[model samples]
Target: MKTNFQKNKIVEHPKESLAPKSGDKKDYTQSEFEEFIIKSGAVGSYMIFRSENEEDEMGISEL
Candidate 1:
């Protein structure tokens, strides 16, 4: 009973958690990023970029 849509519904990527939650406007600066990486580990899986406004430039990276 497999249809074209059902066959295409398979997850292409397992580590494809790039998108953040809606309206979750958390941001950080370069210094903050460096501080975070320093405090925590510098290993991540994926990341998202938003650099329209200087204040709005932020990202979401998996660790």
Candidate 2:
């Protein structure tokens, strides 16, 4: 029995499945973002935090 709400439930990509738990705060600087990247360890060897609105992409060769 699928309802309107159930049907309307949007399915996200597997890679983007887990979202940030906290949504209260917004806006992050490049340095802060870089710190997060280091903590997350998304980057294998070389890493660079680009923007706040960007997601850290892993398992890719540095170019």
**Lowest summed lDDT window (length 10), candidate 2:** 51-60
The CA lDDT of each predicted structure is 0.66, 0.64
Measured against the true structure, the TM-scores of the candidates, in listed sequence, are 0.25, 0.26
Residue lDDT tens for model 2, 1-63: 224654555787577454567774666788999999889975666445565545434333565
lDDT score for residue 41 of model 1: 82
Residue pairs that clash (backbone atoms under 3 angstroms), model 2 = none
Per-candidate clash tally: 0, 0
| Tens-digit per-residue lDDT, 1-63, candidate 1 | 224644555666787565777887666678999998988987567565557665555533543
Cα displacement (angstroms), candidate 1, residue 53, comes to 27
TM-score of 1: 0.25
C-alpha RMSD for every candidate: 14.4, 14.1
User: Candidate 1, which segments miss by more than 4 Å at Cα?
Assistant: 1-26, 44-63
Candidate 2 off by > 4 Å: 1-26, 44-63
